[model samples]
Target: MKDNKQLAGPRRDTIETFEGHENTILAIATFPDGERIATGSRDKTIRIWRLEDGRETKKWGVKMIIGALVISRDGKQVVSSEGPELGDDEDDDEDKVLSRFYQWQLWVRDAETGRVVAGPLDGHTNSVFALDVSLDGSILASGSADRRVILWDTTTWRRNGDPLLCGAPIACVRFSPAGHGQLGIATDKYIQIWALDRRERLAQIKGHTNYNGSCNLSLSWTRDGARLLSAGNNYDPVIRSWDTSTWEQVGDPWSGHDADQHIYRIILNPAGTLVASASSDNTVRLWQLSTGTEVARYEHSDDVLRVAFSVDGRFVFSGGLDKKISQWEIPDDLLTTARGDPLSGRLKIETTSFNSPHKHQRQASAARGKQKARVYISQSMYILTVNQNLKSHLVVCGFMITTSMFLRHF
Candidate 1:
């Protein structure tokens, strides 16, 4: 039987666009249930939108540009970072000129009313770049250019531990999905995993150079917490992944991204089979994790900075420099790749061997041209059939047959 692979399409439908921000949207976070979205913008405003109708339900203004945002899992609260002005005019420069007298702040607010609940979470000496809450909602981690990452207890609204002395200015931080008291910190050229429970480094992953100063880059983990994904900056435009079990790069970097454009954000679908990346190249791409192929791409008019998948993984929401949020839908067959994977069971650990790359021996042949493509395809099929020991023989044979047919047709 043929594996259910849909014919590739030229485009994905944009079901709706949310607009209201007067400036570039810098941050976007969706409710865990996917019913609502919260965004922060360079316009110094935050808006909450009902995803169902693309309606802005609440809005609030702040004193400084909003750079990062995160919504609580329950959808009851939101937190956003304050950043430098969107422009560097003399007046803004003068404000920086008097930096000795002022400090920036982060806010935690009621998600529905836009009311500040607790904040000016004041400790960082510089602009806040990233924010993440622990799985149980008791701890919040904030990263800043001040060269520190702080843990704050939600109940006391106070710092939870001594400042994490990351020597370089912090770029981004994310709590591990496993909730095993782990934190992913990206600073300068390294991605460090810190064990919050022990207050020590758990793993130090080195790859992907940093681009600019802004916390525009991001880090995400698969829902299973088995794989971690890192988006690249202008200095490094490839999306790299690491097996959490060993904290090592899984395969050759997923390339084809524009080296000049920074891959601002990356996220995985709820099922963990697809990865969505938003980039300065004016597009959002969905990559098949198993094949490492970019299966779908959606176009945007300007730099696309942020992207979020709906709770159901049915839709993708993106916002950016264009001052608009767009929703995209993938074809059903493409989505089916995620559904009943041997790794997706609720309580079972994903031990599928599909996580490893298929060692292709025809690189030189394929690189030459179509004349050698047929030979390359057959060798690839042989390798797939021989190397896959964990997946069903029928499934592997089906994939090989499908690829053989595609190559013949080509």
Candidate 2:
């Protein structure tokens, strides 16, 4: 066993690995205060940990595989999905209905005690893949493989209205950050913005192609609710942003990532100035929102599935296929350098569709010199340095990092 004091050393941009899950971690979420994190794993358990000291606070053993997880904004409740626990009960017909027909259940539990508070909220006829809570904590939205997005009234813990039929299997759903009654749904290769207040579809934004939308591809909204971001899939691996006001492509598609690097999720910082991308290429990259420049890249042990920015915009957390979670600290000097006049550069839209089309005013040469020397750590033993050139270069050398311990995978 390792000493607890050694694990609580100084904080840096180093890769700190937390190991507890016996299987792949499918979902991860941080509380609003960024002090605690909730993770659901295929190991059939949900565990909570403190951020300051890597200590497990609470854990709950679940019956079925956990597909997704979401915590309320007030940090009072947690919602998770558990597909039907299939079995060989030949006499039970409902078991056949659940196993063959894809019937699943959603559980609402107390965040502090891990006690069931409301569910087995039964309604969806298939596995639930996505879940989110409204900013006001009054409503909860869930998406399922049955091609439905259901809204629930948290006050009474009852279904609010008839299910919204998404044409394809629902991949992801989120409420707009503006706190209005709008919802963003991602299905197939398109993004549909729905106005929940009016109970109708608001707009369907098009232009990039993707294989399928069922991989928990994240859809993020800027804090002001002015724009939305979705990193394209294996078919189209570009990061696309949409102007919510007009629902049009914003400043063409941001592309520079290798074509083979399939993007899994994208997250915007709290300040709404930078976007972090998780990809299959075993790397995470941060892009400047205004200029669409790839600023930094952090490598991982395997394909990254989920990435999130801290509420305070100081650090980013990521977990994926490698069964590990990595936290990286953001440099204040780097953000200070990137923070500039959003209107300093004139933005232009491209008439062409899917093929990469982007245009932006060139950043001054002198500014690049001052923004150099931002370093990032990944899964490899070496270090990854992101210079002012806006490109990632890896150094293949190893060094000893004292006071850092790597937990056993098994």
Candidate 3:
């Protein structure tokens, strides 16, 4: 079952002023209070920004390109790790045998002061690609190219276990929102659930094939802590739901977008009503869980790399290949109604057509598909049908009308 609801919201201008990077921006993290945002760039620096004023808060120097950035649940600490650095063939002579190995480090800093608090966590034998902080804000879990997921005490900066080994580079790690000592870890082709108390694996979920050499897999837990969601870099993007009680797959995979697009990130809203994904196709898509259908798609000039929703669920922030951060406003009325009722009235327009060639005389129609439009009921819905070859001012006028209507209602 797929639910395609009309997204009613303002189309605000995207702020585009960040300096460009040589490579794609990999990850973004916001402070707990929502005032500050930090971005990990392949440019070898972590840029922190003041979201309210749209100003640079600070920039930290890192030696190599960063792969990920994570802020503690309490918002007091920030952690970042670098991607692997390639060694020159001349340096990798077998006879010379000069250690070709590279090590990744996790640097923890105070969020407010922008000062290093703990590391350069010098332990991972390979690039550290994924990181997560526990719900209680006591432990930090990181996954690395070393094929191990290590747990660290936030206060003591010590390893929690012998390092949970997955036999392949760990791509991502997430702490269950339930704060029940449950953690989810993703490697190249498998997802494993571990019990934090015993430091033992509870279950392993396997399905992905043709796993890319780059670690791009993502895993997240629903707010209720009853279901788990996982997605990764494959032709068929799989959004799987797992029952927490029985540790069983509850429903069929929610598949969308062709296999050609690489899904870089998948994030569930704090309320668990919506899931947002960023793709290499240069678009960010929002999906409603109840219907398993995309409700909105926001286009960008470059591939979207990271997206994060505010704790209140009213705004979505995305960072992309263009090296800029964009904030999207979600309609408050829609969010409120959707939470109260899983199925809200949505007005869906299907197959809009124009009756006349004359500009002002044209009449259009909409199918009102399945859901009644609830968020913007009183607002006008504008539809335009045009020929493929037509590139006149009329088309531009029609787009303007639609854009205006969306902003006014949202």
Candidate 4:
């Protein structure tokens, strides 16, 4: 059911805790369909979750602890970095004698049935640290401990070209949000930008330093691909955004997480307006990307390892040592798009325009800045009504119109 209440004070964000994984949840990815999510955990199993209700829809096992996961653009296939690892040299058991041998490579599987569709794509010689699929799902990028970032052609599930070599082991890799033409690769010391389409290294950014050397940082591209965001851990626990065009830092590094823990991962919501960070401090936090202002926080039982956003940007999913995926409800009235901007089309514009205040409404919105804005929309009328201090603040002569009339204007 939709929440329509216009209450006072800060928005009350609620969370639904989902329990399933036996070990720490290491990675999370939302299905393009928005109805489901895929969570990868140290338990060596990936579980499908229904978003409408906290239901574990499906499950599949892999050979090693899942390091990363990305769903194909069509929402049909899930690409995961999987493989086995050795414990102490004296401890010969793979999983304490679990599995003696297994291949460590990227696996592309069917989203519905968990069937391998294209790969055990092989190239990297070590643990896979990152995986990202292009917007069109025509290409896939995988970064590994071997210091190689390999691009694969999704159609043939084959290596697209020679691996993108780096000076140090790769911590993460991401395809630009705007398209597949550009890629970002990170090592402990610096982040390298590459023009993937031309097979050339563009520039290297040294904005972040990973103190612990775990190579556990993350990278994300802004919606337009004009900027890139990166975060690291240990002594250098901070989130940094950079301009892709100039490869320049955007603003001061964002800091809120505990100084001693690692920020496992960071992702931007679909609208690219909000940033969500998962950390070892046992909390997932949401921030305004433009201002770096901390917006909301969700607590976990243990270290939070990964976070994801629904395609609609209405909800956020976080998972970690708690062995669960938490679904958080974004405030209904919190505008998803930029302030004072209308949605792209009539259907979407109405939802956005109603939230964003126009120049004429600035004076009325100033006082409501510290308060939540409630929007009332119906087929009968489009009214700019705001609720605050338990009273209605109506702008523009306090008038409302029918839905058809509103549609005609947009």
Residue pairs with backbone atoms closer than 3 Å in model 2 (clashes): none
Can you write out model 1's per-residue Cα lDDT over 245-323, one digit (the tens) per residue?
Answer: 8977899778656656788888877555788889887878888877677888787888898888775567888989899
Off by over 4 Å in 4: 1-14, 88-90, 93-102, 210-216, 336-410
| Alpha-carbon shift of residue 342 in model 1 (angstroms) | 2.6
Q: Give the Cα error of residue 63 in candidate 2, in Å.
A: 1.0
Alpha-carbon local distance difference test for all models = 0.69, 0.65, 0.64, 0.68
Query: Which model, 2 or 3, shows the larger lDDT?
Result: 2
Ranking by TM-score: 1, 4, 2, 3
Encode model 2's per-residue lDDT on 65-184: one tens digit a residue: 788899875567888987744453557787565664455788989999999999889898877878888755677899877888999898788998888887767778987755456888
Question: What are the runs in model 2 whose C-alpha is more than 4 Å off?
Answer: 1-13, 84-101, 210-216, 338-410
* Candidate maximizing TM-score: 1
Give the TM-scores of the predictions, in the order they appear.
0.78, 0.74, 0.74, 0.76
lDDT of model 4, residue 278 = 85
Error of 3 at 1 (Å): 28
lDDT of 1: 0.69
lDDT, model 3, position 46: 85
